[model samples]
Target chain A: MVKLKGAISGLGKMGLSHAAIVGAHPEVDIVSVCDTSTLVLDAFKRFTKVKTYTDYQKMIDNESLDFVVIATPTRIHYEMVRYALEKGIHTFCEKPFSLTIREGEDLVTLANQKKLVNQVGYHNHFIGTFRDLKRLLDTDVLGDLVHFTGEAYGPVVIKEKSGTWRSDPKEGGGCLFDYASHVINLIQEIIGRPTKANGSQLKRIYSKEVDDAVYSILTLESGLSGVLSVNWSDETYRKMSTSLTILGKKGKIICNASEMKIYLKEANSKENLGKGWTIKYITDFAIPVNFYLRGEEYSAQIANFVDCIIRKSQTEINSFKQALITDKVIELLIADSKN
Target chain B: MKMDKVLFGDNQFFAVNHLSDEKSREQAIRFKDDAAIIRVLDQAREIGISTFMCTTHDRIANVCDYVRANPEKYRGFKIYPCMPYAHKYANAVTDLGIIGTIKQYIPGNIFSTFTKGGVAFIRKDFIGFMELFIDAEMKMFKGINTPVIFIQNVLVDLILGLKMFDVFKEYDSYIRKKYNAEPGYITMNLPALLDSLNSIGIENPIICSSINKIGFRMSGGINIYEKYLTEKTFRPIALQVLAAGALRPKEAIEYIGKFPKIESVLFGASSKSHIQETKELIEQYL
Candidate 1:
């Protein structure tokens, strides 16, 4: 198969990171970059040693690119994805597929009609431990799962000093849009979409007109409950962390990302196991596993996209249908918060 | 003349709840000397309603010290301290040792010196620099002539808990429906804060307001006090409570005219000029 060429738009931190990684990959080439800010573009250009442009359309017009990674603010997602897909280039975009489900649906339809590869950035779920846990659930290794819970928290933002895009609701702003997608995507990938979605979104405590925090719950189609909690106002000022605890008929699994601890207990067991488990008096045993990913999901995603292009296979790496469901879940959560 | 008791409270809008703040108690204690509080408290007295005092573990001393300094102004009115710590620390089911603390500090009492470092008997046990307020209130109301009003500090803690706003809303609705006709003083929670109050035996109680963090400026420096007030359902309740305890005398009269339910308002003061302005607002409203 021929190697693919990739370009990154919005040479911000995420853009620069993606560019550096793409430049280093053997099967992919970081051919070009784009951003409205010349200073950002120039800095990213020097760091990645790649050509840069101020406009994305111009980059698409000039470069012979295999794919464009849309790392711009969420508001630009629809336009950027559409422009790239229109040119028959596979596109990789950030989460919050777009601000609304309608836009997400449009992107999905376009990706399907043109037979192009579309991947949304939900790499956190690509962690080796999560992959192992998904496998365990698939094989009923944990018994009938009853509940899936996620808790994520971080320091509150009192000022716009961190960045300006977050404070503006129009730029895919607010905690729900900015952060909750990771939780939503993880849960959807594990238990499937919720039969019902309802929960709260906190816009502010002292600050006005912007969401500073959010807490939500989603009930899945399998009668298993999923709770997604996120707070930006924790006074302790900790970094972002999300942990998932899955309760099964015989045991429970606790996976805390921030602490890097995973504890498993089979019901009515005398022994507590960490990595491997063997029990006699219990109906089931819980096992804990962990590993690292060198952008395997992103690389696998791109490789899968390329394969779909060459062999005309169906594209299914966190596909548009799944992302659209995530969009709808976000919409419902925001609505719950407002009421 | 009939006396009316009106309670006004702010929706604690800070991202961090009061309990979550490492300095919440200390911060509240330091603000005890803030001249604005005395002015507001004095203004409430001038309006002819009983002066109501709010309690925080960190700031209870400030209110206690002010009342001690001005015995004459606060003669007939009693200081109703909402004992928050007891409820916070002691659980009958989980910790039986805390019951003694509750037995000592009751809500109603006039403290000669409300100091954070004072001592009181929690049942037979003597502990702390601050009084255990729950025990004191039970004593104050044993057979008192004036009816004793017990406002649950739970809702206040809930506000300080800084959970989801919807939790506040759910509790607000439940409290109002259950306690609307029940007698005695209860702090008015949000339109939704009443639920938790009802769950704990108090129903549909009146809520109070204290405008603290709501006065902050927004992105363009717009004073969002009005917007915050409207969004939290305080406007209608303010109309109901304008005439009661601890408010400017003239403001009380005008507020009473606007809403007949208001008989008194609770005011906090910090300086002579602030007190004088409150008096003027009251006089003008009158």
Candidate 2:
């Protein structure tokens, strides 16, 4: 059992989280790290023996790596991931894969051509309740999905404040990317890709540039319709909250990160679901992992990346193709908001 | 150590619900003003629960100001200020950029340390910067009785994952020497954190974690936690004991009450009846 060598390119919040997750893997050794923050890199240099670099190319060119987790800003994900793919290293880019659809598609094509084990960091796909929902949707628990309402809200940008990358639309800031990408990706995978979005609204409550909230009505490829509602300016929530509610002729299902609630008109014998309502905890469906962090889903996503790289195979869960669809949906929603 | 049998927490005032979002909003609406928060704190104090374990939110700063102003009225009240409110730094970093965040959050004395800093600062900046932030977070709780200072689970679990066991030692020494308070750790993974702290030779560590019947957010599961509770010597505090309102109060209290080694049980509620009932239950069961 040979170990794989890994490197991480960013040292932002998500980057540091991935470093902790990737650094703890039993089958991997973190050989190098790259970030613009001297303070963060200094901490890493002082704490661990991983080689630190200010330049992304210097880290990639200097180290012999098996994979790289690119957790940089959304504006630079294209260049960072493309360089990693071209270097023949497995790449795991963070969520909202790229700033634009063209950049996402180009990276997708390049990763495919290079035959790399590419994945994106949409950790929601690895959540226990969501995984169960995907499986249950394939079953008859919800007969012929009629509609859905996807929502995410957090107190991210409440007060009128100066701008960061989050408030800058060109830098991939906004509710659509920072907050709602998770919901859009979940809607794409669990339900169907939103083919058309209309009457969309990107409201700016605080920020000068990017939207603080996003809302729209969506029609899926299968012609199933739904509504998307997300807000980051709501000060009521303690943290980011994302949930999904789907309706069918037979019953309905509502789910979030912690638990799931389902209602049925009649019992489904094969799935062991009874009539009326059933409440299921995430622990029942959560898959155990070697390492634990903020949540099981985070470590599970990183472990999936390492496993896919070890097997030299691409992952369907949080894969680059799946993320490209999310990028596409973001563009559609933004275009609709203008109308 | 004058540990209270039943402690009142401030999670509800800050809209921190472990499971449900709707409940958090309800609490936010209920505790909308500083007067509302002080009202609950005063209620809990009158109900004989004196200690308030809360985060260093801006609103908590206002609460601290009120309590400091009216000392004789609210006599013998204590607060356990949790350092490094992650959201404070997160929102500051977003608005002010990295360097501005440092200048804004770190006390003026930190720059003096930086000016005197040499290669030693480079080597020890990670832990040293943490102390600086600790100093900043402590500004709001001045002239208040804080018996225990806690590091939130976000940093504790991050350290556990990084396997940076040495950071705990630095924090332990700093909190004890500078603040004259016992250092406490709050984590989701109690077993792993206990292992890390024990390996660092911090004996009889105080840990706050989820101990529930349904194992909601209990990282290593209920069995491992039970093994530690009955077998281990560390001081334990149970939170989310009701499993985010999932378990019946009697069943939850009775299950935890079976473990006599649990030193304290922390709960947050808005109503006086709920607090009185819970405090009674703790006395009755434990």
Candidate 3:
């Protein structure tokens, strides 16, 4: 296997997670860490056994790394992803990719022109249960889709106060841009491009500048309708999770990714997939089987990424350009916000 | 005014503001099969809906067109042409050409004969009684043997609510005496009128429109029925009506199943879908 020399930027929660895994993976080497904080840099250095620096530019200039993980805030995503791609480096950036559609489009164009391996951190698409769902949808398990709904919300820790650049709009701090990307990407995976789009946002009850809550309604090209609800300044809750409920002509699929649960309403059962939750016919019992995420999703996502890189495969994976359409969804909400 | 004997209900009345787009118009049309005019009549027939009245003469041509196009479909449904004579159409009657003969009997001098020199003298007689001019014209219409349902639009309710009982009493009396007949019902929206109906025991039923519709039955009169039992002002009165058992459960259901007292429900339906949905809703809910 061709091993990749990888470096991680912004040594925060997401950056640290990728560093830990990349450092340990057989086909990967965590060679350098980048961040503005000396304290975070020291922690990442000790943990990953890699050189660390306060300046991302210096790290890119000096390190012998093949690719970098752009886990920095959304505002800085364009610059970081652009610089990395310009230097012929592969990248995996945390969503939403960029603060605006123009920035995202520019980076996407740059990456495509360079023919670099770039991925978006919409790991929900990579989750095993969701992948199984995608498989079922492809196999006509649900038949023709009628409607889809995705809901996710959690407590907002002032991302700026958390010592990250997310609080800055330039970096994609707000809930509409940051959290709703996952919903938008998942929707694209289920249904094709929407023909019409409208959305609304509510102002933060806590913070003044950014939106804390948002709702979007989209009508796909196939006449399939969808709704997405998101919010961040939720003191009553903590931890972020997503649930995708798809209703089709024949059957339905309900996936609660945070809970790692997948429920299917199908006509029949598949034996090798493992024992399901509960099974009954259409009227008698709605859902037939439920699958737990079982840590297989994360591993599966990473495996797909590595396999694509090695095989030079054309897959949706490592396509941040394709993933940036969701950023436009955020721009829509911000424009029509009643609050 | 001389109206053509047919009318069509084509003016698309979206439930909210307007038919904003093609989807809205499509969805509205999808609510029914064929068209709203035919669907409403058909659904009403299945459930025994009898008469339908349009509150404004502006809808008369449309109503006639709807009836003329589908004679068999609307055969059983009686069309009651209601005029809001007390308000806008008094001057319009002349423009529509029916006022020539009536104007002769009353004379234009009474309407246009205002003299700046004798203004104080006319103030006591006609200052606040412009409705009287229309009342005289309406009396002339009584000769046309067909039934005329007069709608007291919601603005009349505000006048009554402001305790201007004289206006309500005069309008009510004029429709009764000059027409040599009691109006099938006065479509005012004040519940107190229902109380007035109950007190004076006027046999003419007061049909209430939707809350925003501005016609009157007693605020609590609709509460006497099951549907109004949940509304804020009407709920308590609804409970009292239930306790009093003014209407048997079976009877109340039958009453709501039919159109409100003044003929039929004249709402704006834009598409065939709205017609179908309205038909289905009336079948299921009404």
Candidate 4:
């Protein structure tokens, strides 16, 4: 099989994870890796013999790459994504497509005009439970979605930190942009785009630059109203924990990383699952991948991207256009948090 | 003319007891009559609080009638109506259904009101419905000097959450052009509302919200609120400064008075002594 050669920018945690996944995948080659830190580039060089560059633009110019994975800070996403798209390279960017709605819209327009395969790294979409939930929703088993509640809590930034860019409002939008982005994407995936939203973003423990907790109420285009609560300062959770409960007229789907429970008033689907409630563990349906860091989602998402490019088909991945919706919602929620 | 530095709130008169159910019930029973409501307003006026920041409760229409009737007694009395008094419409909806509720509360030109309602419904012109609703809410405060009108927190936060910037713009323009009053917003989240107002070209708006020391009912907490109060440009009218009676009168007044941009402190008092004591505290601390 002809492998798609790709480069990755910003060797942070997500960057390294994506690099490992892409390198392990049979149909992809890590052509180059770019980061501002020489130490990061040196570490990547040791792991794989791919060329490394401190300058992302230099790497884009030098390497004839098929696509570039961006896992940079929120502020720099606009410039990097624009540069790669302008160069006609299919791009995969991390969450929070851009800081502003205008920038996100511009990127989406450009990518569509160029007919490039663009995707945002909302990896939760690729998770086994979420995918199953989406399938159930698609099957109309749950009937019309009435509401959904998404909660994401973790111990990422419990205390005031000075060094990291994640703490900076300009670079990263703290917990609201970082953590809540996942919840928003999942909500959008289950229910259609939110027509309206109201919520609060609180800076409970972090510095004034970014918020540590967020609570929002969103109304989807289908009149499905939902709530999202995310707090990164909660130390009770051992790691980043996320759960979503989707309530519909007929039934409800409650899903987390570990398991998904479906409670139905009446059976509606062909899947031999019993009537009142059915529970499925992640291990029961999770697709085993070659590389795993958090979950198989990283590998699954990368594979989907590659499959779309190789097949020359319309990408099933969440495009820049789709991700822009989430950004717009975030902007509104952040505005709601002010005062 | 500038509004009073201390605006008397009508929450006490409306029986909005946040702390206890029994107090709420007792207050509700005590202020069941318009005479009782006017007695408190009279007490507030005696304390030199000329401005009454109040909801457009059904009883307030009677209060407006009383003030308009006794012009000499209420000389220079002003009301900043915080609308749409949600309970009125909620009760109306419960009793009269949707269209009947509209007919019951909608003021003036019944034919034109129904015409607009029909067209707005067919076209889904939410802005039209919102303007009509605002006009209807403002009917109770007619012929009164309302220099500033506030969108209640329920509606304000709903609009903010919906990203309905055009609705805010329309409200700003309608309140300015029709009523000749500055459109103010009361929200649980003050900083967010200010940002939304700024986004829609409203600079330094009059905003009343919960601003307290211990973050009681303050949506985004007190730290960011303090930053906005000190650094941002806006006329902040502090409410819930006592944090639902959490802080002592002295401590609450002093903490709020320390904020440089606070133009007014809005408090509710049903008694003459409480009103007098609150005025004295503001004078001493603020």
> Best candidate, DockQ-wise?
2
State the weakest 10-residue window (summed lDDT) of model 3 chain B.
B234-243
- TM-score (C-alpha) between model 1 and the true structure: 0.48
Give the per-residue lDDT of model 3 (tens digit) for A176-253. Answer: 666677777777775566545665545564444555666778777788888888776553332355667888776566
What are the DockQ scores of the candidates, in order?
A: 0.01, 0.35, 0.00, 0.01
- CA RMSD per model (angstroms): 26.0, 3.1, 26.1, 21.6
- The list of candidate 4 runs beyond 4 A from truth reads B1-286
Q: Model 2: runs farther than 4 Å from truth?
A: A113-115, A263-291, B91-100, B107-128, B230-233, B257-260, B284-286
Candidate 2 local Cα displacement, residue B278, angstroms: 3.2
lDDT of 1 by residue, A1-339 (tens): 467888888755456545544553446767788988664553344333567798789999899998888888889999999999999998878777888778888999999899887878776554444555565567664677877787665554534333356556778766677667777777788656765666665656433445767776778877777777866544343234555677777566654321122334542242334433431110011111110012234434444554565566666557767877888888887777767
Tell me the TM-score of each prediction against the true structure. Answer: 0.48, 0.90, 0.48, 0.53
**lDDT (CA) per prediction:** 0.51, 0.85, 0.51, 0.77
- The parts of candidate 3 lying over 4 Å away from their true place are A45-48, A157-164, A234-238, A258-266, A269-300, B1-286
Give the DockQ (C-alpha) for candidate 2. 0.35
Q: What is the lDDT of residue B64 in candidate 3?
A: 56
Question: Cα lDDT for residue A107, model 1?
Answer: 90
Instruction: Give the range where candidate 1 chain A is weakest over 10 consecutive residues by summed lDDT.
Output: A283-292
lDDT of 4 by residue, B227-260 (tens): 9999999998989888667678888889988886
**Candidate 1 residue lDDT tens string, B1-286:** 2323443221111111211222333434444454645555555566553635444333445555666676676787654434342222322111112222222333233233433322232212222212234334333222212222334434343232222233333333432343221223232223223334444454434544322221110111113323434443222223212222223345444543443333344443334464455545543442
